[model samples]
Target: MTDKAGIHPKYFEYCYVAFVAFLLLSNIAATKLIEVPTPWTNLVFDGGAILFPLTYILGDVLTEVYGLARARKTIITGFALSILASLTFWLVQLAPPAADWHNQEAFEAVLGFVPRIVAASLGGFVVGQLLNSVVLARMKQRWGEKNMWTRLIGSTLVGEGADSLVFCTIAYYGIITGGTFLNYLIVGWAYKVAVEVVLLPLTYAVIGAIKRAEPAYSPQAWAQREAVRAAR
Candidate 1:
């Protein structure tokens, strides 16, 4: 269902749903920390870091095919649903546990969103994702299909940089400081960008499929859009 004249995407709903699902699940996973030992220093990050990069990839997919306006809408939708999930957990945490229910503590431990964490998650997501979309969209307009790889990597660098700084600073600045803080920030950012780069082939496949599947998507269509944007 669409009101637009030249746009009706077949697979966008799937992408949108997957984007929101990953966003929520990653937040849950972030509650758990991952540590691996090495001679130099242990690799440390919240579990969500493993899965969170997919959201940005999805953001790229959305912007690459659907446009930035749609990508921003999806980002906001994810933010709203995340808030709802957080509030729901807080409410359930407040409820008294049944005598038979022995897992309240576990539930709180895994599902709880402290104020700092909540602020960090929501703030970082909005800022990083919007930046990703905007940067990617602008790059696409300039290079079209000629520099797709550069567009993806360049956007990830800017977006992931902002996300790592905002999320770590708000969530762990005071508690973790000095060299350890720097490690967390650098490792988190590097890990995310590396993952996306590793998965570049898959991203290309997904984008190509969606571009072909969308009835209104074509190189000429996009070029016209670029012309329209320039005129405005």
Candidate 2:
């Protein structure tokens, strides 16, 4: 890879948009918990569990393609937006409803996130995403851009592990038993890692396509472009 100095600041805006979208949508979906019945037992998880893992995948893509600084900016952007959304929801819930608005209760039920839950969500997201980006960025520096699968899996394990543990503990500390909370954490982490594993092929393709389409900030690509410029 080339030096960071050579890489330009042109960002792939779509990735940032997708990252924020996934983050916000997951938080919205987390308001509900659903059960998945299996042969031996039922697997219970928050609705966000189904979608939250995608954020990590996108985080990986952002770091891998655009470098750590850009990924950090994207992560902070998502985090700020999530807090804004939560505050907006809270304010709307607190506002007086119109005379004919009988559905305020329903609306609050769907959108009114508790303060503890909001804290857990925001804290988990920032810590997990930063860890993910830092780990992958460091691993890429160590491994020289090879073995993407290893980096992805390893980083997700650490990142999702922290995310699940923090979010579950804070969000459901008294609501669920300790054993159940432990199960939730374990299952959530496993499910997230599994999603990334199953989607490895698709992730690879997307990463490759994005790298080809937007090679502006990639250090190695930047070096090549500069070499060609020198030759010209």
Worst 10 residues of 1 by lDDT: 1-10
Q: Give me the candidate number with maximum TM-score.
A: 1
Per-residue alpha-carbon lDDT of model 1 for 21-132, expressed as tens digits? 9998888877766778899889778888877999989999999988888888899999999888888888998999999999988887777655456678888898899999
Output the TM-score of candidate 2: 0.89
Q: After superposition, how far is residue 29 of candidate 2 from its true place, in Å?
A: 0.4
Evaluated with lDDT, which candidate comes out highest?
1
